[model samples]
Target: MRQSLQLIFTLAFSWTLVSCQTAQVKTAPEETASASTGQADPSRQAAAPEGGVPELTEDIVFNLLAGEVAAQRGALSEAYDYQLRTARLSGDATAAERATRLALHMDKSELAVEAAALWVELAPEDLTARQLLVVMLLRRNADVPVLEHLKAIVRISENKDENGFLNVMAAINRELKRESAMELMRKLVLEFPGDPRGGYALTIAALVDKDFAAAEREANTLVTDHPDWPKGYLVLSRVFLAQGDKAGARTLLADAVGRFPDDPFLLSAYARLLVDAKELEAAYEQFLRLEKVEQEQGDASYWLGLIALELGRDEVARGHFLRLLEIDGRSDVAAYYLGRIAEQRKESQQALRWYQRVEGGEHRAEAELRIVRLMVATGESREVFEWLQRMRIQYPDQVVRYYLMEVELLREHGTPEQVMALFDTAIGALPDSNELLYARGLYAATQSRVDILERDLLQVIANDPKHADALNALGYTLADQTNRHQEALDYIQRALALKPESAAILDSMGWVMFRLGRYPEALDYLRQAYEKLPDAEIAAHLGEVLWVTGERQQARQVWQEILDKTPESEHVLEVMRRLKI
Candidate 1:
């Protein structure tokens, strides 16, 4: 009789827990709904007052209560074990779902898979159960089962308003391997041949997998079969772009926009492609059309503003950016561009106000730097230095950057001694900073302090052995300021090997070669460097070598071109003076 009474009490307790859990599930949010006793269907709840309470045998009662008690006490492992056992023994959908959620919470993926499979078996009509199972199977790379459940989901969703194929494709695109996702979509297309979404999914998957030929083939078929679908043309254009045929992409998108004149996606693609191809005028016209078609004008306005700036239409650019200032999340970016336009218009105070309005985003740092520059331009150098100090304190992570900016400002407006003192203070603060050391070394080279330059550059190279810039700078300095021609050659050779295509290193090699009296080799390297980077310094080097090699006509032409472009080029002028030309 005592044992019987205990059993009755346990049963009553189980029924109470089920009722409370059902109530919570009905009211809880989706993310927290899984924390309830089980995922009970509304129909099942209506059919039974206890919400489809499973048969409460002694074992079921003990395990269910144990799991609930363990979970409440923050003993998730114990709860998961009891819940999984209860699910297996009772074969209850609710128990299985609870076990699955518990295992997932514990990050026991394999155990979650086991419970999820059971839940799906017991509740084949439950979409949530199927989705959970699909995720678990995908995590395990069980492609065959994943495909089966995905097909089931599609069939189930056909009766509903949602497109299950697209939903599954999105999920798998993030979770599954690219090739595996592409193959699965291919099979799904074969399974649902009449569904255009399947073909589109396959094309996107193939594109993501970088199988351009397959993507092109599928995209072509989609466009041919569904000429009314604008996405087909968009995907085909992307395939051409993936294959580096930007001209083909531009041509196809042009035709697509002609066909679908008011399609926002197609029009936007065509406009952006034209911008990339540097056809700014045509892109501006397309973006104007896009602005009309698009309900939200943020993207179109942003691109229009940039294109106007590129086309030297500051007034037009300002109008677009001003319009964008009214939109959400665009105020900071719009303010930054407005600041740039103000600077271009020589409205220093207006530019300062606009830049100050840029509170955050990718442009905040640049905006601040511009503000400092404007301050110096306005003869507020003292105030600018004070502001930089405050900024350094406020943004500790950007201390090095602030110091570098200060160094540049001092170099332009203050004396060379001030710049050197600032570098000393920055190096004291960040004793191990390689960037600071390298910058100071470059500045030292400019000051003709060879000892300081060598010490600082050697420190940087010691910190980062593969610092090609430091190696090249050291090499060029030694060759120019001292009689270390062979040592300079060795250092420059190492730097060249590290960055074979670096124009700066190539120029260093050419200069060191000239210092060693290898005029022909110097000419070759200098020519290559000048071709790579048409800087005045490099042109000066190339011209000097050409003149020494008796190519006076070519040397004069090179010097004339650079002088016409940069009349204040000291390097070219100094070379001409030294050569008595």
Candidate 2:
């Protein structure tokens, strides 16, 4: 609403100047001409009485001034009325345009439609005005008028650019039925085949209608005719990819890259396909090549760094990230990765500096967490506490999360009594905080405090019935530490329904099923959960489920995999003790 009002005021101000120019307000023209040569012009103050207002001559000029004043006063409807009157009385195209714009800004669609029609009538040769009328008619769903106005708009300027036509067609697609929009685009294509945009519009229309055969045919023709146009290849490749023909799309991009070797778009497309195919080395090479050609675009360099990191070439990744920081200073992404690299190399102070450099953005929270971890690892417990306290004050909105992080750290390293005291203190300060309640509940589950766990988790559920994490925690606890198998199944099922993709919830559901003696069902869910997460706890569950089902070899293999990842994982140790493997 604010933006609309701003635009209306701008239009009102500009039109007022145009109205003044037309009026040729008697402003000492001879003196003005002499003033051009730096000569002393006659003082225009003598032309009017002192303290007298300058006079408005034309009715159009008067109405324009009134409208400008009305808009400035935030009386947009009054402004529209005045401009509309001027347009009707003087047949002024600018007045009609202003009226239409203001009416639309006010969301008075009917008034906007009427004013837009007037604008087109007053300036039939104005392509922009005709386009506005077409859009207004589309809003009204006046199909016939829309078709007429759209045809006029395209007929006047279809040969100009495909982008303009594509934009109009995209707008039409949103306003009209797909079949109707496709029909209109088909007519436009037939009417202006010379314009590549018309054909592109037809391709999009066919694609929207799910007529993939027609879309491919039109796309092929478009690319064949306009080989230099990169968008054509992109659109065609997208069509191929959408049809699940990744190879076809890859081939198309590779062919395009061969033809347009220096084209960044084609190179990026080919590189991404290679990445998706797990050809990371090839993809990395291509991205490096693209970075050389498109130095200003840090996207290629960013991807190269990511791929290098994934491939464990940390030194190579560091180089690319450093180059990216030089190219795009706005990104804290490079700093975050550099911090991770430093941490991996056991450079604690260097890692801290890199993490500190991440002042803002998506990486800030993770960077702070990394800093806490580094401090804890270096045995600087007091520094970690001070850093967290500063973070709590600096990021007030995230204070609760910071408090929780501190509690989590204590739960891992401090005495159980100390962790419990901290949790109690936090809950007392923010009594209604579901996150604090859930964290305390999980801690209670670890200590076999069934009553406290149930109370906190149930309170969370009472507040938000769809709190999936709390549901999963309560259900897993009842399943693991208690004999309430049926009750556990119910809670875990609810959590699973809320977040079907959550591996944690899936593991809970499988564990509860295993407790209920539904071994086959438990095996299915556990296998799926392990595939998604591969966490130590999930591996424990998967291995136990396999062992129970008489797959002793597979259970050992799963345990070995977990041990290979985390040799001393508590979950793996517990599994070994329980399963006697």
Candidate 3:
């Protein structure tokens, strides 16, 4: 029964409290008289044991049952009030703890403070009560009260280990106000000068204050004083790293590794720095050493695989990833990378199986997309489309993305009519979808169906007047395929105003200006677009503008560069033929 009660507190109360109430400020003592009534406070009723409840009267039992039911029904504020009533009536430490957590959940700091104090007063030996009280006090920046609690915690840690105190300070430091925090840490350090952990805290405080020289000085002291402690080396290396002194960090780690040659963490740190520096071979060696020292470390194998992949040692990469998968079954990352390796080796079926094992992660969506692409590559186009349809229903949140993917696949391998039919289906489901409308407009423009293109794009613009891509598409269509140069300029100018840095829109504005015979302005926009996007299409437009502006030699040089970059580009051939080059 005690275990069950503790589980209820842990799952339903403590976890929620910990997320947002890492630390808090203390509050004024609870009112002696009740706010709702002029009667004296009620939680002064009686005491209860730590693990067992006291005998409660009818009213207290009713209120406790009501609080539980209210909490279960998601009436959090109502539940809190009921629990508050129960705490006041019963004077049970358990009731007070529940009230404290509920008040913190409701963000009622004063009530939380009162309840937490009651819990601490009833259960003075309970560290969790003290911790919660200290956190509440810290939240209000109740520095004097906080200092007393800090001293209590320090004493508690001294009975345990100094490292415990240092860890608590580090964990809660982010919530501390800067000056008061540094002052508190400085005081702690002064009081515990012999403790290397305090020195470490002082070093961190100095770093947080951006007093680099002091950080360096204090860090050096910790390193010298605690040569056997790996954390001292790690902290000092971070001090150098934060200041962009990578070489200094590397030198520091190397010196530490020499003294502590068998330290797996020190070796791992050195290997990571080597990877960051792109010294791949040295990093690989360090990881190898680390793996031998700590055989169960999957991260060592994972990094080894990554480095091998980078170096194009595919066989070695495959071995490491396969080993990692055997050791860590939930390694979706290893599964994803192994799928890539299989695809590279032309084992598409094996790759699909590997991708299927990926349940969910950052890589799950990418793995699914890769499966579709690979299916299409193997002439399973119909299968790929059906699979996407099932996935659209399976992952409702990703329906829009699946629709767009299907559209792209149809455009690549199916007829224009097929692409249009998919768009119709998608737009029927989401008639006002800007993405679908914009995609359909671009598709219509490619087919030279200007009326359909204009209708779709105009509908998009009506829905979202600031759609820059739609504006640019409409402008480029008018400028390229019709004699409406001035209308094109209006649309393109609006687009440029909205997205002045858009290279595609800049290219459209340039092309429209070129149609208007404004060669100088056209040349400037084209040059800007070309510099932003040095692709084959942008280069072709830039070369044509240069030729028209009488820079014939410069035009030849630009076209030559494009040909060298993409020797078989049909777009380059069309540009050359149109300009008579």
Candidate 4:
């Protein structure tokens, strides 16, 4: 019943707003010009000041007529300027009002601010001028003076609605002292005892202060005063979420949703909460419902795509994102997600183009970094060096990617001193990064630096013993470089156990067994790995193992098979020719 009354009141207020132009007593210039005119002069009816001829300015009438002609003919900038001159010359309220609106329409912010401020200065009590002053501050920027001015208007406003009071109170809270904002609101509530806006303001203030008991008291008052409204219940839901009671939050939201079933705000927030809880399947259902009800909302399409992607429905998510881009082609978020999907598919050019769309938007820096990393991965990594140099200058502390890229660069082409510098930089910058530690361990093992490799790999295995790559690296390095056959076999077996079907890990296992003089077991694992991944490394491992398994002819044949494809197999040729086959 209270919501119905508020709606009726809103309707009545809107009617009054539309009907109150008459209530404001507008003095039309067209009427005065016609009243003063005995006859229309042919030259005074000339085209315009800038076009045909200048009008005979007997008074403000001629100026207004000329200004109207200019404004209607796509001369807004000139029209505003001329109207300002005319209003300044004659002090006409009607002319000043039109000039202020026209200046704003022309995107002349300073001129609009000046004219509106002048109007308010002339008539300090003019509600329209005072409201426009507040609007100016809102769009231009927020400050303490703006909040105080807005509060003054709220105090003097002839009427206040839920939205109006909320706007003023929110602006005050953002742009002024918090306590002052609450006190100003309390004064308004005391002034207008009928409107529930005061009680709502108190609820917001109490919520800001973290005084939940006071906020709940004020919210309960709003609920009692405006039983049909959903804002009161919405506030209560936020209070529950702030207090960390998810069940209580859900209950209050369900109540608000029951009351405001068709409200997009309620559905949007509820859908977000469901998404946050990792219930993607249920969240997708809610997004589908929201889209069914309102297919035009970008948020609905975006959420559907997000939930679909999280649920592994890649093609479905892609279609939804494409549709969303069609609806709003410049959405940076959609562009960024599409770029990531393209990157996952290894469509480098498509990924680059998609990321390029949001180059100057909010996601530009992140997209640029991703593109750099993709380039580095493809062996076209020279540009990443330049980007890293520039990033070191721009963002010295925000270390996300440059560290990894630097390590890769050093590994690719750097002296021992420079490589050690990268290691030092990475360690000092982020000592706890598992990937960095792993990188250092791999680099040391590749260079045959056994002491560093042993130290780092021991640390890695201590932290994550089942790390398959670390196991494979340490085992292969040990077996190939030293007489640590038993230790190599132990590490390789652990790695193979963790990733039994992994082609690379299986190759490492076969190589370690071959080192341990277990020819048959080595041949079996190598052949199985070759069947799974017919790579050059697998072929070489299987061929070397075959020679030891007493299949010299088959080993030679295998080595020949590998060389026949491109004639570039270093290990294959070494085994066949060095063994004198």
- By TM-score, the best candidate is 2
TM-score of each: 0.77, 0.79, 0.71, 0.45
> Residue 495 in model 3: shift from native, Å?
7.2
Q: What digit string (tens of lDDT, one per residue) describes model 2 on residues 1-581?
A: 01222344467687765564344323223323221121222332112223322222244354556767666667788778777765554445677898889988999888888888878987886877877777667878746646566667666664554365665676677678877777777776666656677677778777777788888998999998887887788789877987889999999998888888888988998899999999999999899889988988799989999999999999999999998999877458999999999999999999999999998899898998888888899899888988888988998888788998888778767898988898888789889999899989988888889889999999999999999999999999999999998999999999999999999999998899899999999999998999999999998998888888899899889989989988998997897897776
**The CA-based lDDT of model 3 is what?**
0.79
RMSD values, in order shown: 7.9, 9.1, 7.7, 20.8
Structure candidate 4, residue pairs in collision: none
Clashing pairs in 1: none
* Global Cα lDDT for candidate 4: 0.70
The whole-model C-alpha lDDT of candidate 1 against the native structure comes to 0.83
| lDDT at position 21, candidate 1 | 43
- Tens digits of per-residue lDDT, candidate 3, 465-565, equal 99998999999999999999999899999999999999999999889989999999988999999899887887788888888888989988887888897
Off by over 4 Å in 3: 1-91, 101-111, 122-143, 151-177, 189-227, 235-245, 256-269, 442-581
TM-score: the better of candidates 1 and 2:
2
Clashes of 4: 0
Error of 4 at 418 (Å): 5.4
What is the overall TM-score of model 2 with all chains considered together?
0.79
Cα lDDT of model 4 by residue, 357-410, tens digit: 774677777887677767777776777777687877787764545676676666
